[model samples]
Target: MSDTPDTPPDGFEFVVTGSGVELAVKRSGEGPAVLLIGGLGMPSVTWDISGLPGSLVDAGFEVITYNARGVSPSSAPDAPYSVADLADDAAALLDHFEVGPTIVIGYSMGCYTAQSLLRSRRELVQALVLFAGLQPSPISAMVGEMELGLIDRYGEVPREVLVFEQLLTTLHHPLLQDPATVTGWQQVLSAGYDSLWTAPEGFRGQLTASQQWITSGEPTPEHLAAIDVPTLVLAFEHDLFFPPDLCAATARQIAGAEFAQIDGVGHGGIFTGPGDSAARITEFCRARRGL
Candidate 1:
């Protein structure tokens, strides 16, 4: 069952089945493939909104973005899935496209999925870039617990409110200090809230997977040390969740991995703020490809 269309504009958009779920996948541009793995509960459109996808496309690399199973437009399988399950879904997309070893970029929870991909299907990866990525730690787990607890306690809080709260906490302090910027983000959140929150099962399934992954005790330092691909780890200086120090520690786990910190941004900067993250990613990939 081939999913490719006779004429796909720029690249392609189709559904691929993996791990007993259908994943919505889109590919664009014309150079080497670059797979983008988004954070937990993030839809593929977030990549477009963040300018990462368009930036990469302009930089001469084929960009691939997909809604992970349980994300909107993607099928939500039964519960009790792990980060490994998400990784498996990623691998299935790569195989479906016959993508060779390519650049893989993971953000936030997507970092966990990316690591799992490297461990399970190392041959599919040529290089790796981790943005605001972290290995699960006690502190991180506690934060996750607190966030989930709030959701459970509120019972029926507005999605926009939840998103706004997240933005306030994860966006750089400077961004928040600017009323216009903050308002812009609020508008974005308000516009997307319905699409994001309408699919309750999608959110629940991904949340369960995140909780399970955080508590799974996998991706230890030993597992991280096993990744042999050229890797770059980017940490945001003002990130509250994955502090720069811990992100650097994660970088150290990968042999020969390059680590850098994006100053004046928080955990959400890579996606929301005006930062050089996209340029850095383009440079890294170009250097690796000898472009």
Candidate 2:
């Protein structure tokens, strides 16, 4: 909701990659390291709103968050992008900060990059948390293509319609039922939709990256089973993006990965009301670290 991509929070700095890309990075608290890979078109600062980083920081882990390439203030080199490229950027960021074998958390779209991280740079991750992330769903893929098709056919979905569609899938029935809550979020989402989100082609970058993932058949069952790190697969009860069933399936694929579902929430609820998610992350990380 904040338009200050150029102005990050205290303890924030930029990490320039060998490829000459600049990543706007933020770090908080102190202890062991936890790197968070954000969702599509999601700003790193929003992690603070989720109360996730502060909660983890309070629990004795330094939290690191950053805007991926194509997200504003970070280099958006080209229109279409690859998760491997994005994961490499994440690796470079972690390398710059000298954090390793750290807990890696990914949500929604970021989950793809996180998977790539495990396959490509296993040394950087100690424990894994896949929040509302999974391989591919036919229905989800259909929706993505439909949206892109609509974009190509027409200009962009009407702002009002886009907001409505976003809510229909993002929030659960309870949040949408609250008149004041919906109105508040509608205003917030719309106000910021064009400025930092679409202005730098962030939204397109996200959509294309996801489409490419669905196309490539990444992190196949074999790939998931091959992951040697401790993994926690987290799902929301009513998430259309990555439902509990799919999340559990992903957990099943990963040897020794634990699965947990947060009730009474949707995809967006994980961040909007993050107490449950934060608790889950802390519990799993502590258990893995023998704390």
Strongest candidate by lDDT? 2
Clashing pairs in 2: none
- The 10-residue segment of model 2 with minimum total lDDT is 1-10
lDDT of 1 by residue, 1-291 (tens): 112224423433655555456766788898889999998778777777668888889988899998777665566665546788888888888898886888999998898889889889988989999888665456567756665666678744456656777776578877788999888878887777666532555665666677777787655778878888888988888777678888798788889998888888887776666377788888899888732
RMSD of each: 4.0, 2.9
Give the TM-score of each candidate: 0.85, 0.91
- Candidate 1: which stretches are off by over 4 Å? 1-12, 136-139, 150-161, 178-184
- lDDT value for model 2: 0.79
40-149: candidate 2 lDDT, tens digit per residue: 87888777777788888888888899988777666666456678878899999889988768898998888898989988998888888988877556767877787677
Residue 13 CA displacement from its true place in model 2, Å? 1.0
